[model samples]
Target: MTKLKGFGFKRYHLILLGFVTLASIATARIVQLHIYQHEFLSEQGDARSVRNIPISAHRGTITDRNGEPLAVSTPVVTLWANPKVLINQKSRWSELAKVLGESEKSLAERIEKNAQREFMYLERSMTPERGQAAQDLRIPGIHVREDFRRYYPAGEVTAHLVGITDIDEQGREGLELAYNEWLAGVPGKRQVLKNLRGDVIRDVQVLQNAKPGQSLALSIDLRLQYLAHRELRNALQEFKAKAGSLVIVDVKTGEILALVNHPTYNPNNRSTYSAEAIRNRALVDVFEPGSTVKPFTIAAALGTGRWQPQSTVDVGNGVMKVGRYTIRDVSRGGVLDLTNVLKKSSNVGVSKIALDIGAEPIYTMMQQVGFSTDTGLGFPGESLGYFPAYRRWGSAEIAAMSYGYGFSITAVQLAHAYAILGNNGQSSQLTFLQQEKQGPSIPIIEPDISHTVMEMLRSVVEDEGGGGVRARVPGYHVAGKSGTAKKQAASGGYTKDSYRSLFAGVGPVSEPRIAVAVVIDEPREGGFYGGVVAAPVFSRVMAGSLRLLNVRPDNLAQQVVKQGQVVRGGRS
Candidate 1:
């Protein structure tokens, strides 16, 4: 019995030793994996559950000089889905389509076609209410992402100036497109843990921080914009005109205060968007400026030292022959001084003056005043109106150009030119942004010569039987010119019935605070002359703008008398 017990003990001891050896080897294998190969294991684990997610940044806001919001971004929700997962949730698609305003069949087809795609946009830019309702369904693979949408508070009133953005919140036109880079924000990235259903479980770490877009302040004044829009709309409706545009600028700063177009589209609702409605006509469309160019013509003539504002020109029988074309005046002003020539809008007289000064000087003056060039507003599709090379001009071309016929110019260009004249022949570039410091003005013409032209334009408004008499403001000295040009046909000849009536001028001429330009296209019901169709718009807008700026009235005597009358009536 003693011998058997000892053998058993030895067998048991051998088994125990083998078990101890196996336990040590297993522990050593675990230590090797955890201490030396931990990085590889961790990477594999992360690959299965972690993801890099994009973080969207908010776009910038566009405001006016007064800090009024023009274009703003509002937070919204965008719904997306994994097509492969959504295709299986077919029964829930009808409810999803109803909320998205999409037909069930269409939504089903889109999901089936994009089944291979992990992510697809189910609905973009949904209101918070609609997004919540959609989320209530609790369907798998459906996701809601926070996003932004652009909103224009001023609506169609400032549409053309502020412009619109696309579905992805990208600027498409106007100031929006011009400063897109400055207004677009940069997206960011983050590391996150996702569940088996591809839902974000927890945020792990920030990979990159989002950079929000910077805000932009424009030079547009909301008050002036509304006034200009209202006046232009009224004119279009009253005259039964095809289209019209109005622009107002601050003469001292060279900043565009207001720019409005008729037949404008509501940026918020683009269902009826058309090329005509979307076009910024004041900056893009060019027409023969007619007699509006005559002021510049007279200025060019006076610069030569051979002619003065009082110089006489014989407009014989109100007709001047230039090649095959006959330049005729609206009235028979047989002989008139330079000022009278502009006052009456005498085609023959101005043509004779242009012929005397020669084309090169006129072209040079036009170029100096910023004609035939972009307005420097950096707007998209801006027209650099046609000013042909002086070397290519003939007597007829010069004669036609003298009365504002040969060359073409945009409405803003005409306003800019007049602003230069108003600014004492000092030329500065126009800006869509608020000017912190006034730019140095370059001398374009002699100050005395510009003043002389300004006085002559004032005569056109103040003088009886003048073309721009209707443009006269009650108590202010208004300096401006009128233009009526025949529209050129696409097939190559002038359209007889179609006309572009334009009036460009400066208000409170003694100090010249504001410059306004108005263009009425194809006025059928009312008279098509610039004096009749466009000057009144200029008068109302200029007067209103002058008052809005609180500019000290140059004609305070009239204002005082009017106030005195009110007091006297009260006393009585």
Candidate 2:
């Protein structure tokens, strides 16, 4: 052995000392790593491969009263990319662009533009198969995220009621928007192991479990919805109207059974979307109700104990001067009872009745029947219709208000008013949700007054000379009123040709079950009168709905009599 550093020390001793120092350093490092830094190092390693990713929650399903699905959420996948990493995969750009239905140049530019961003959505709401194809490319930084897409099964038939959702499964309009939070579920998180390529290796642990959204059941009947939709669409086409709305309410439940609008878009088809087409016209569009308010006027007069069903009013030559305006009827009406006034749809008669009853009673009647207020359905963008206060009433204003002019109301509101009459003057809050327990109803008017008004309205539909003869349904008695209001010109006054045809009614007068209101805006073809254009639609829809609801016929004897069959001794 040779001596090196010290004179007394041998070379082997020096070598042994150097070996001991190296072994001691190695031993100290092992102890430090195993005892002190173990937790920190493990965390760092796990951070590289394990990720806490959010789990998409399932959205709720919306069903009609009959349990028919109106809107639903289906599983889908979204493709996102880490722009910083994806920018390097230039060779696979063309394949990615092809799968995304985008130009390769645009895709490249987007990635370059977002170079600083670690994550960006490449494509959202892709079908599972398409997303899997993109994932199969194995391009680094490209990832598939689980998501959901909203589906509307009834398409345009239930579009306005069920509404549509955005690509992210968020409700955008109609009832969907009103109930978004209830329908949107809580997303969860879990730790997952992934490889360097960003493909998930395994689920490490569940941090939180996803909470699925709650299911919603609407009060609508799908069968009646389809029927009303078909009839209103047909009427709009036949009349060449700009737009239309129809609403049906169960008189017993105060639950909206069917609500439909023309010029509506399919919620399922995003390409068919338009601002004008998406409006729920039944609740949003307001219009003067025209002669439809005559029955209410008669009811008001009756409530005053000054007029009876047979009380007569002189509508001389179908025209009368009130303030500065002249009111007229469809024809010369000399003397008319309250029932005949409704049967002939006399504006002058209602105006005389309003003048005699004063503004307070008429205004109170209108206000109590839901005019000038939203129906409390909690629908988004519902209008509070314009109803001038009684204190603001002049003679001219009162006259115009009598015949359903100088004020405005939504179709649903008008339907609700008629429903109040059908419910024997009992008024309840309206709802779109199926009732587990219905709220208590309040009396809007005396039951006798309501009954008298209902009988008068029945004469308007059933009598041969009645204005709403077309609204008659076979084997059932219908109580309703027809209205035609001239639209106000954009400049001033009223337009010469633009008109809104409306028909509001309740069916099976002996046992009222449904109240319906129809409004056709700007009908340029066919007959524009409410009786001609709107009543037929009301007839068809009411007939089909009554049959579909399995309502017993109240006028079967009249139907038999019209069919020339006589019933004797309980035999037909």
Candidate 3:
């Protein structure tokens, strides 16, 4: 009995030893995996399921000076699918195509064509509701991704100035392109766990945070923009003009209050965008300034100390000989003072004055007034119009330039020059951004000379038989110049019937607050004269802008007197 008992105990002990050995082996393997091989295994698993996805950042908002939103980014959705996985779910393609607004056969061909590509865009920039419908269909391998679409609230009214963006929300023109770097955002990275079918199962980690673009505040006023647009459109339709442009600048601050062009396109809807319609004509198109250059010519002559505002010149028979070309006035202003030379827009008188003062002084005055140079607005396609060097001027060239015929300038450039005149001959660098400080003012011309020229310009609007009488405002002292130039032909020389009608002016002459410029291209109705076609636009825009800004009417006394006279007449 003792021997049997010992044998049974030995058997039980052997069984217990075998069980301990197996447990020890299993524990050793587990330790090796958890400490030494763990990183490799985790990497292999991640390779199959983890993906680095790009996170889109929101584009910046563009606002006017008054905080009105001009451009904004609205949320949208994009539907994408993994072609390899999507090809297997062909049965659901018809339903998916219905939501995507594509035919089932087209969708099938697209999926087949990109079967090797793991991902393909099924639909881009769809509404949230459509995206949700696509998601609710719950087709395997199909997914929704968030994106943004650019929206323009002001539409075509501010199209040329504000500009437009592309499908990726990148600025393509105008202020948008000018400040693209400051307005574009940085995209981020994220790690997500995806299934074999390319469906995102869960988010693993936020690898990087997206930084949204900064907003831009422009100096443009929506009220003035609308007013300018309305008036310019009216003038274009009324005169049956081929094209037109209007620009309004704040005299004191050098801020562009309004810029509008005809044949404008809606930035919100670019289904039929064209290069011509998208062009900001006021800044991009250049033309001969014609009689608008008369003021500067008179100012240059005055600066020579040889001529006074009352100085008289003999415009013999309203015609003068300059080399082979003959300069003539529109009418016979046989003898006129310097002020009347501007008022009458005499091509003959101004040419004679320019020849007397010589070319260097005229060129110097032109340069000071920001001619033949960029306005420094940094706008894309902004032009620096052609102004020949003084060394190239002969008698004919001098005469042509004197009457504003030899050179070219954009509408904005003309407005800027007028602003300098209105601002007491101080040049403030032009900008589209609101002025943070007053900015350093550079003296461009003698303030007294500029004031004298301004005074002479007033006669052009206020006096009867003046060329710019159409520019007269009832309650303000309007000072301006009118110009009519034949358009240069593409081959050479000037076009016969095509003319550029221009008017540049400053309002409330006692305390100049705004400078306006209007250009009408090829007016086919009524008359093509600057006074008849372009001056009215400047007058209407200036009057509306002054009232909107609450500028105290400088002619309030005159208005009251006129009202009193009318009342008394009615009583009588």
Candidate 4:
């Protein structure tokens, strides 16, 4: 009986001993976690407790010289989703799809397809009004992140100049693409503590102040740009033209005042536009500059002492044969002086003078005038327009070139060349920014010769030069030339249905403050001559630009001259 009682006690004691051993092992693990592995466990805890949210950076604003906003940033919300959590939530998706302006099937498919990710963008760039609706709904597992979208306030008016950016806020065209590095700023970050509700209770900044991008101020006057836009658009539509472009520059400063290209795109929402609409036609498109280049040939002759403004050759019968092609004037062959050659736009007259200058010197003169070089306006796909090196020449090249068709040039290039004539023949650079101290430059063409050309240009606006007469403004003397080039087809035939009309000129001829160039491409299935289609547009723009610059009227000069003549008569 004693042994049985002792055995039972021993068995109970062994069981209690086993329980103590298990308790001791558990305490060892607790110590390891609290002491030896404390840091690792703490990091694990923090990983699940803390959250990272990115802070967005806004791109800088682009403004005109007058401080008018051409482009700006507006705060908006973008819808996002955690794909794994959002898929199969039909009701929530249905509501979201309605707000996002998408069908339910697309929303469901987008989420289902991207379920492999924790982060996914459901919709991009929704308007503030619509985003606010999604925000109010507050669907679980859905989020709205703060972001910015760039807006062009002027819309299509300055589209080709300011350019546009893509969905990721990367600049892709014009000044935006050219100065992208300077325009895109550094992004910043922040950290915060939130109670499971994802509501911030304690916020701490993780980075220094976000730097805003530097402002870009262009040389463009908004008013002049608007005026040019209106006139060019109207001309393009009226003439039923395929496309057109215009450029205005300050001769002294070499600053571009206004540049307009038709068939322009709106940068605001560029969803369905072609590359053509986005192209800066003034800088990109090159066309044969017919007849308009004749003056340069004459100017080069005068500069080189090969001829004077009075230099003349009989423009025989108004027709000269060149390689089976007869270069003829708009009129019958007739004898004319230098100014008469310009006024009548006699191809034969200019061709004879070009022959005297010789093709080599003429090409060199045009090259030095900037026609051989690109305007370098920083636009994408800018062309130097081919000017055939002096080494490449033929008999007909000079004759054909004198009246303007053998060489190709962009509208901006024409403006720069005319600018040289206006600036007393010191051809210089062209600038897009008003703050730029640089200018277009070339060797001076004896100021006297330039004055002679200036006076001749005045005759263009007066009664003698009929084409330029239409280009004249009421009070300002204008000097300019006209061009009408036959458009060649891609299939190797000249398109009788097409012509590139052009008007290149200088304004307020007394002081010569503005230089302008306009081109009309394939106008209205009707007569497409630079003088008839483009010069009228130039007249309107020059009038607006001169008015904007407050250039003193020549009317005052006329009064003073008349008064002086009267006093001189009395003194005599």
Candidate 5:
């Protein structure tokens, strides 16, 4: 009894006192250290006891002007591992890999790498379904993290314009690559603290808030894009062409309504990738432009006071010897003036205009109309078309270039050049993204000349005997140019049978609003003439587009007009 009474203290009280005394001592030590060794304590805490907390933020959304989501973030799961903990559940390794779409060895390697690190990722972007399945399996040391994956709802139809992103969420192509800074938001960083067990303490100090990416509203219209894609795809199959491209832009706004290129790949599924198909041909490829360049040359000549739509030039039976090479027309000529020259796309008459204007003058006009210069469309890899400097050009070059032969132009350049006509001889930057509708464009060319060119182009569509009738809609007026250019062989000479058929136009002529360009590359078999191969496509596209755009039609006047009172065969 005396021995037991010696301590006179209960075990529970002693335990409590021990805790209280330890706390007091710890407090004293902290207070003393705060007075003397504050920096040292802070450094030690920073080394081991400190925690990191991450603040969540949203990625940007890419949408059409109508708020239709073109590119959006879909939730994904990232599988993480803690090697120390994972080792305890090694038995589940083989099973885990099957669910994760990875090899067991791959998973083992990921876990083993982090034997020292507290946490590491086994995989970065696993689909949500598989991640959830993994969680259900309840394998140890495994964690699923939430992340955003960019998804394109419109698929390949919009891929070339909207573009794709890498796994790290960087812009890769097209507009995405061009305006990356605007589209990408700042990533948030958080410092997280975990115990030795790697369990969250639930007391997190947020370091930085992630800035959400900006909302990108594109000018492209979804409906128009679909229509362009559908029509171009149909043309590819129907014509058995090597490839095709189409671009539609609003004349008033300069906004790109739609851009389509076939042999496209869906960004969502990368397995179908082909470099040839992935390119935005409308903006990237340049060609001699053939007869399509005729209108621009005519526009230039008219603006410079050298010619008029009613001006006459003898096209002499469609065959003429200029120097050594003979230039021939698809349709042999009559006494052609500006109108029939464009309608028949006559090389003979147009060459004469080019000669009048001088190759250098028309070449300068082409530059003014955006040839051989960037149009600043905000599309990745867009190129300025090729036109030789006046210093480098010869008289033969100038003569040949008059009818769209010596120089090359991209489809967009042709469209832009034609847009100057629609914009009343004003050239604005081509925009793939939408832009505010402008009032009237200041003249990039003489409006008087543009007016005549417009009139002549309208006649091209209205005249049934000429090549452009198929491009005419019954009620709406359309003005455009067509080209069937000789294709250069991969070897050296031009291919006798191969031709690049293209149509570039602007329409609802009464109140012209859109400038469209279609290029059917190597349409090799079906009709080689621009009117036959490209004009019908132009017809289907312009008609459907006008109807969709809600443009008013001038019906009775169009029907009552003299059926064949069309302007024919005139020089520029």
Candidate 6:
């Protein structure tokens, strides 16, 4: 057939032409997929198989000065699920419940409750191994997220000082809240690959690196902390007191060696938390100092070169009238030297000294010793104990101020004041951070004056009729004062029965090493005197602390040689 021969094709040629047309169409589709639709398809695939996930940064560890762990962060995982997918896997719900320690019904209810939402936490803070076990079950939509749980190794013993963090690992109190920014590290991001089951197959790449928090080294000595906590707790129980606080400080460095509160709560357990139990009383709560301020009044007099340790004041009938306010003392009316004023805890004696010195010198001396201000700790909720201005002082006000009345002072403030006396009038700012070297100290008073005051304080514990007789250690000479202040009634005047017993002291009187303060609030059993309730705590805690710090004894029993035979008498 020659007709249309130019255009006509044989059967084999037609087949070959058909194959070429199909091949061309296939190549175009390949080009569309590899080039034109490449970006869209890649995005879709990544949506299902890749993800940008956040990596949780580890929280910092908090340790005592001796490197003992106080607070620590442990690695854990939070298990979550896509309820839409999980609800479909009803049969696997029991298995999930078994790992979660929940009943099957409970698991079902949880999943159903969150079914509309794509994400819900099945469990938080599960061990890594436990989380992995659940993840390996191959249940669809189950996911594991990295997290941290804070743990306090010292528990209630260090709770007040170390403080606590919330579920999200944010510091909430004490030193934790004060240095949160320094401790909490920045979280980072990373790209990861996943399979169809939502399980991470491999890490694709690190978009950002996670930064771990820095470790905190506190100034507290764990050993001393335990000792103080135990002694304070025991004192609270023995005295049937409402609450108590104790603080130990290094005289030379002003480092708070130990700070404890009787009503402290455990930082590890959230359920044990309460406002009353969690408050750091040593730094936060303030009370009238009572006889604790007597020494300062005497110190002010000594500064004027008008009084000496032997200077005498007549506390006639143990009562003095100042602007219709009667200042009375429990001691017998008599003439007492400056040293006896403290030893007897005579309110009248200190009042006379305060009246003679006027208000400015007493105010200046107290201010220089760190009263009416924060101890520079920057502790959360720290109180600047109220010390009225000298400009406002009347005769009654001055007399009241002399014996620790009409104002307030925190336990730590009282401790800091005593620490200056112990440190030879060198006032160092208090610190919770361990000091590598002695920080700069302000010279608060002349060395001779401080020395005189320290000796006077020593007599309060060492003399035969000293008020702080119970505070004396067997081998160490303790210099301290006792205070029994009346708590002001809510209406106006002070309550007759309610009292705050206090004892503040420094040890190894010859060369001071440590200063400690103890406060027992409202002792109902035994005596409410500071010498009775707080001084014993000081004695036991100071005695043990001195031995632990290897401080040599300054008041050891006198040894005498008699005919080549050694004889030991009572403590010097």
TM for candidate 3 is 0.91
Q: Model 6: what TM-score?
A: 0.91
- CA error at residue 345 for candidate 1, angstroms: 0.5
- Which ten-residue region of model 4 has the weakest summed lDDT? 563-572
lDDT preference between candidates 1 and 4, better one: 1
Residue-level lDDT for 350 in candidate 4: 85
RMSD of candidate 5 to true structure, Å: 6.5
Each prediction's whole-model lDDT (CA)? 0.86, 0.89, 0.88, 0.79, 0.78, 0.87
Ten-residue region with minimum lDDT total, candidate 6: 563-572
TM-scores, all models, native as reference? 0.90, 0.92, 0.91, 0.90, 0.87, 0.91
Question: Tens-digit lDDT track for model 6 on 462-540?
Answer: 7767888777787877799988888999999989899999999998889999999999999999888888788889989
Best by TM-score: 2
Q: Candidates 1 and 2: which is better by lDDT?
A: 2
How far residue 287's Cα lies from its native spot in candidate 5, in Å, is 1.1
> For model 4, how does the per-residue alpha-carbon lDDT over 241-294 read when each residue is reduced to its tens digit?
999999998888788888999999878867635787888888888888887787
Top candidate by lDDT: 2
Residue pairs with backbone overlap in model 6: none
Full ranking by lDDT: 2, 3, 6, 1, 4, 5
Q: Model 4 residue 319 lDDT?
A: 82
Model 1 CA deviation exceeding 4 Å by range: 1-38, 101-103, 556-572
Lowest summed lDDT window (length 10), candidate 1: 563-572
* Candidate 6 RMSD computed on C-alpha atoms after optimal superposition onto the true structure: 5.3
Q: Please list the Cα RMSD from the true structure of every candidate, rounded to 1 decimal place.
A: 6.1, 4.8, 6.2, 5.7, 6.5, 5.3
lDDT of 4 at 475: 75
| Residues 1-572, model 1: lDDT tens digits | 99999999999999999999999999998998899989999998888899887787888999999999999989888999988788889888898889889899999899999999999998888898888988898888888877889999999999988898898888898888998899989989999998877878898999999898989998899999999999999999999999998988888789999999988998988885789899999888888888888888888999999898778999879877778887777778878999888887888888888888899889999888888787778899999989899899999998887778778888899889999999999987799898889988889989999999999988888766777877767668889888888999999989989998899999788988889999999999857888888987988898888888887777655432232231110000
